[model samples]
Target: MNAREVMLTIPVVLAPDDTVAAAVHKASASDLDILPVADATGRFLGAVSKADLVRHAHDPDARVGQLDSADILVCHPDHPLERLDHDPMSSVPHRTVVVVDEHGRLCGMVPWVNWAVDEARTQSGHPRSPMEVRTLSMHLHWRCLDCGYLSARAEGTPVRCPHCGAEQSAFALHTED
Candidate 1:
């Protein structure tokens, strides 16, 4: 299926100017992995996950625009879901995949799954059980050498820099205290 067919149309969004408190308040009322952030003109800026926001909630006055971002999978509405599987470099994305139009305006979101890596498992004759497919994840720290961006994910393997779009080869394991 294409992304459009699997997307959830969300009417609410957070603006970059919104405060961290605002993001936390709004996210508290939603069940999405990453809340969509858009501009006044409706251009997709980035996203803020509830987990990430909660960590930064101490700085209640911080602007959402200034938040550090992790790599998010992005695709056009017409992007075939199966395309992610063919690309071996793709990490198993379990966050929200933002769907944008040609103009980079937010269209909707397709909640990503572990299908990429699961497919690999299937190919290796050890397919994941339904429960195992959604098992607990490890939060890892990854630093992007290209842009010096550091991000942590409790879901899939991080393979790129969220700030600069660097490839997996450009990343190094980072440790956070």
Candidate 2:
């Protein structure tokens, strides 16, 4: 499934003209650490974090537009999770990803935990097809001889160590249970 299929719609959203006090109230009522900020037309502006509200505690009346953070990770709804080279959410302070349409309008929001759970499910095989079932039953341990990086896989060693980029030939397998 794509990101849109797993994203949460009807997320807590704040208007640019909203106050930090309003943002704080909304955040406190919801489980989200960050809330999407949009205009009246539904155009995504950025996001407002709880930390942002705390940073401006002295000025609770400050407009969200002036303080909303643009340092957010945005992805198209159709974008596949595997196509992402790295976890862009990790680079942002909010640790959330905004899903926008081609028009840059807000569609949904994906928390990092949700994305990680989906990734893990995909990697571990959700439906557990015949081949995947067999693969999941077997555990193979690998140790990179070059960098001493260790990993466990259901299949053979990878072409390279994800940690040190060492070749497969530089790995030793220990299939001990």
Candidate 3:
């Protein structure tokens, strides 16, 4: 199935300028790990997690700032979902990526599970657990050789980096336990 066929049509989101308190309310109400952050025009900015706020809860000043990811990790809505790597043990089960338009407008989410289930439905002509349908993700886990930051520019294929641009292949892959 195509990405558009399995994409999440409506996703709850918050504004970038929204306060931590507001974000807390939304996440609590939804009972989800992460919430998408949008701009005034409903353009996706980034994601804010409950853990993110809790990490800074001790610091009373943390909530005063934007409730958005400092460095946003995003994916296209039209991309294939079977290409994601999901760790079931992780707190957030989101192999799904937040999708945005070319102009950066919030569109929808394409979850890895949806792809599997949809594919199973197509191949088997019946519903099958997404877990049973497996697809190995080819994404390279890149890390900054200098500072130890995970490179978010896809798994492989070198490109001019923004962190420490020393050619394209400077950063190496980093996998965490």
The predictions' CA RMSDs to the true structure, in order, are 11.8, 16.1, 14.2
**Candidate 3 TM-score versus the reference:** 0.51
Candidate 3's error at 97, in angstroms? 0.9
- Error (Å) of candidate 2 at residue 91 is 6.3
Model 2 C-alpha RMSD vs. true structure (Å) is 16.1
What's model 1's lDDT at 118?
Answer: 49
The superposed Cα distance between candidate 2 and the true structure at residue 164, in angstroms, equals: 49
Model 2 earns a TM-score of 0.60
> Which ten-residue region of model 3 has the weakest summed lDDT?
168-177
Model 1 residue runs over 4 Å out of place are 85-93, 115-177
What lDDT tens digits, residue by residue, belong to model 1 across residues 1-177?
A: 677877788766889999987876665445455678899999999987655776786788999999876456788888766564333333533655788999999999865445443454566576456743543224345555445566664433456667888776655443332
TM-score, prediction 1: 0.62
What is the lDDT of every predicted structure here? 0.66, 0.63, 0.52
Which one is best on TM-score?
A: 1
Give the per-residue lDDT digits (tens) of candidate 2, residues 1-177.
Answer: 556867788557889888876765555444455678889889999987655665675677898999848445688888765454444234332246788999989998766533443464577565423321222124336655445566775556768989889777655543222
lDDT of 3 by residue, 54-96 (tens): 4554553455235446323355656554444444445533344
Worst 10 residues of 2 by lDDT: 128-137
